[model samples]
Each structure stands twice: as structure tokens, then as C-alpha cells.
Target: MEISVKDLTKKYKDKYALDHVSFSILEPKIYGLLGRNGAGKTTFMEILAGHILATSGEITINNENPFDNQHLIESICLIKEGNNFKRDLSIKNVLCIYSMFYPTWDPDLAEELVKIYGLDKKAKVKTLSKGMESALGIIVGLSSKAPITIFDEPYIGLDAAARRRFYEILLEEYEKEKRIIIFSTHLIDEVSLLFEEILIIQDGRLILREEADVLRHSTCAVTGSIQQVEAFSKDKKVLNKKELAGMMTAFVYCRKEEAVAEGLKAEGIPVQELMIHLTENKGA
Candidate 1:
């Protein structure tokens, strides 16, 4: 599935949740939707999911508008952190309802996941713990087999082992059947390996969109003598730096080949570090 978003804007009063954001995703792969807390990730996902309307702009899925379109809606599945189902309903009832909506829904897979997650079929939605609720959401999302599936912080209240199991299952499922999966999480370092591409939104703008490998290699840390580090970093885009005594360490945004020629010790920048350096309190 392909998505084309142009000049997308969502506003409330005088504030813009998404400000003229424009980007096109043509390939189907796992995408990491990342940003600080109020950075419009949810707004962008909601627009694509047709949960809310954009203040201005256009969104087309496979060249057709997804807004309230039944055909496209069936092809999309979005699982948020909380309460996506009726609290009074049983787990079995919830699965039955979702099965009717998603054409590719796998009841068998859902049942299997319910057992694996240790969720009782007779338990009401409200009777389950927070982690159980998230697990149920995960089951629906995976079993839906939607062409475009989104998980917005879907593992809340889960223990470390449970979280790891979900990650493993997610990757295993993705490999078996490829689709456009948009995953948003604050656990960047842990899930960085799962992303084929990365999209970073800051404030209400798209600040960075690049392939995972390209982004990782685009920046490097150079640590050596102050004079040599400064000489190499000159006329280059330096994301961050530190100087102590006679030593200097700088994170410079440049190609690996160029960094090798600088006569300094250099290492590829970590994804977490790159994100921090790029988005950390820009005004401060």
C-alpha cells in the first residue's frame, strides 16, 4: 500500500497540530514514527486512519481518499494505547466484532494469541489488567492482516518479558507477510533494529525522513586532539560537541568516507544519540 500526503495541516484555535506537513511513502515496510511527546505523531496517524479530518491538505491511499471510505477502512487497522473496545464485552465478543470488519481477519490466529497472552475468553474487557488490554489490542492488530497497520504506543503497562515477546512476534509476522507497519514508541534504542525507515517529526514539522542505514551512517563521532577535531569539523555540519582539557569529541553530520579522511578516530553515531542531538531543545 502507498500513501501520499501533501501540505497536511490540522489546527485547533490558533495552534497547529500538524503544520503543512508533506511527504510521500511509496514502499511497504516497517516505519518508526518518532518525536517528543507533543510532536504531532498521533495527529498524523489519525489523519491517515481517517479518525479525524485534516484542517487542510490531501491524503490518498492508492490514489483514492481514505476518509470514511469503507473499502479503504477495512484495509487499515490502528491500535492505540487504551480502551478500543466496550468495557462490558467479553474477549470473545470483541474478537467476533473485529472479525466482521477486517476482511483478512484470522480468527484462529486471534484465538491462538489469546491463549498465548493468557487472556480468558470469558473475562470482560474491564476485568483485564492494563497489560492484558494491550495484549488484546496486539492480537487484533496482528490478526487483522490489514495492509496498513499502525500501533501507537501499544505496549503500555507490559512487563519487560512480555514486551520482548511482542517485539519478537511483530518481526516474525512482518517477515512472513510484508505490509506497511507504522510503529511509534519511546523505546527507541530497543526497537531501532525493527525499523526499515525512520520519520522524525518535531513540533509540527517533518524534520527527518531517511532509511535506517543511511541515517545511522550519515553522522559520526570524532574523538581526538582538539586541533585535529576542529580542523576536520570545519566547514562541516556539526550536530554536537564537547571539549575537555586537551581532548575534543564532536558529532559531525557527514559521510563515513569523508570522516575517514579527517585523520581522526571516528565511529558511526547511535540512532538514539542522533535523535537527541537533532531534536534536543532547539531553541535552548
Candidate 2:
């Protein structure tokens, strides 16, 4: 299930939600789609899920277009943060309807998750709380078992424990059946370890796309006196820097061994910090 996007663009009346974005999802791995607010993450996901069409350019899976393609839509299960179910239907009905929609849906998994989440099948969707609804949405996403599963902040109101359980289940399911999972969320630290690859969008443009393992091994944060930090970071790619009490901390995209040889305190940078440093305002 390879996704190939070539110069994909989505435009509003006056602004571009996605601007000439192009990338390829070539494997069945968990991809972290990261960016700041209004960075076109949702827009790009919606376009890929066949919910909307791009204004210009193209996005295809295995050389087939997604827009208005029912067969293609069934292969992609997109669960948003909210509004994934009908407000008037009961929990059972919602699950039944989705089961019919997705040919690959697993009723046994859905039933098991319902008990684990403590959701009442008889309860109407409108009567459930925000956390309960999130659980239901996650159940649908996992049970669908689509070739391409995209989750866009689908755990909005879930408690810490429930959210943690969801992550566990997600990993279990992925390991059971390796498929393309593009996850878009603000909670990067919690799931950063699960990400096989990372794609960063900023102001509607694709900025950074790299293997997580490579970034984890290469990117470093060096902390030392101002003179030492400055000399070490002079020729390196510094993503971020700060100075406090005559000491400087430079978040750099460089080798850790080099910084360590200089006697500076160096550590691998987290994915959350990498995203922040890469997308931060350079002019400010």
C-alpha cells in the first residue's frame, strides 16, 4: 500500500492549505505526520482519505486516484478526533454500519475492545461523553484493519490510562498485521518511539522527512559555556540555541561524538524538540 503524492495542493478561497506537497509512503510502517497548527496536516490527510479533492496536482495509491473512488476509500480508514459517528445511532448500530462499510472489519476485535473500554452498546452516541466517544472511534479504527489507517488526533478527550491502552492496542494490531499507519497528533513525545519515519509540514509545505532512527542517532543538543558552544556550533546545522547564566545550549543536527570530544554535555534531541526547532520562527 504505497502512497505517492506529486505536487499535491489544496487551496481555500484565499489561502493554500497544502502547497505543492510531494512525498512517497513506500512501506508498511507507522509514520508520524507532524507540524504546527494550520500547517495543513488535516487537509493533507483528508485529501488522502478521499474526503476531499486537491485543488491542483495529484495523490494516488498504487497508481489509482482517491477522490470519488469507493474501492479506494474502503481501503483507507480515517478516524478524526470527533464526529466519527452518527449522533442519533446507538453504539452497536454505529459499529454495525461501519462493519458493513469496511470489508476487512473484525467484529471480534471490536467486541473485545468494547468490553475493555467499558462502553455500553445500548447507549446512544449522543448520550456518551467525550472520552467514551474517543474510545469508540479508536475501536472502529483498529477493527477496520484497512490497508491504510490514518488517525488524526483521535484521542482528544480520553484519560491518560485510556490513551495509554489505545497506544498499546495500536502497536499490537500493527505488529499482528503490518500496514501503513499515518498518525497525526500534537502528543509527539508519547508516541515518538513508535514512529518509523517522520514528516514535517510547515505553513503548507513539506519541510523534513527522515527515518526516526537516523534522527535519533545523529541529532544532538550540546550544552556548555558560551565560548565552547559557539566554537563547536560554528559550522554545524544548529536548529535552536539558547543562553542562560553565561552558558549556551545549542540544539544541532550533528554527530554526538564530536561534541563529546570537546567536553560539552551532549545528548540526543527528542522528536518533539526537533520538530519545534525545525519549525520555529527564524526571524523572531
Worst 10 residues of 2 by lDDT: 275-284
Cα lDDT, all candidates: 0.90, 0.94
**What are the per-residue Cα lDDT tens digits for candidate 2 across 212-260?**
9998988999999999999999997888889999999999878889899
TM-score of each: 0.95, 0.98
Model 2 regions more than 4 Å off: 282-284
Top candidate on lDDT is 2
Residue-wise lDDT of candidate 1 within 181-212, one digit each (tens)?
99998888888989999998888888889999
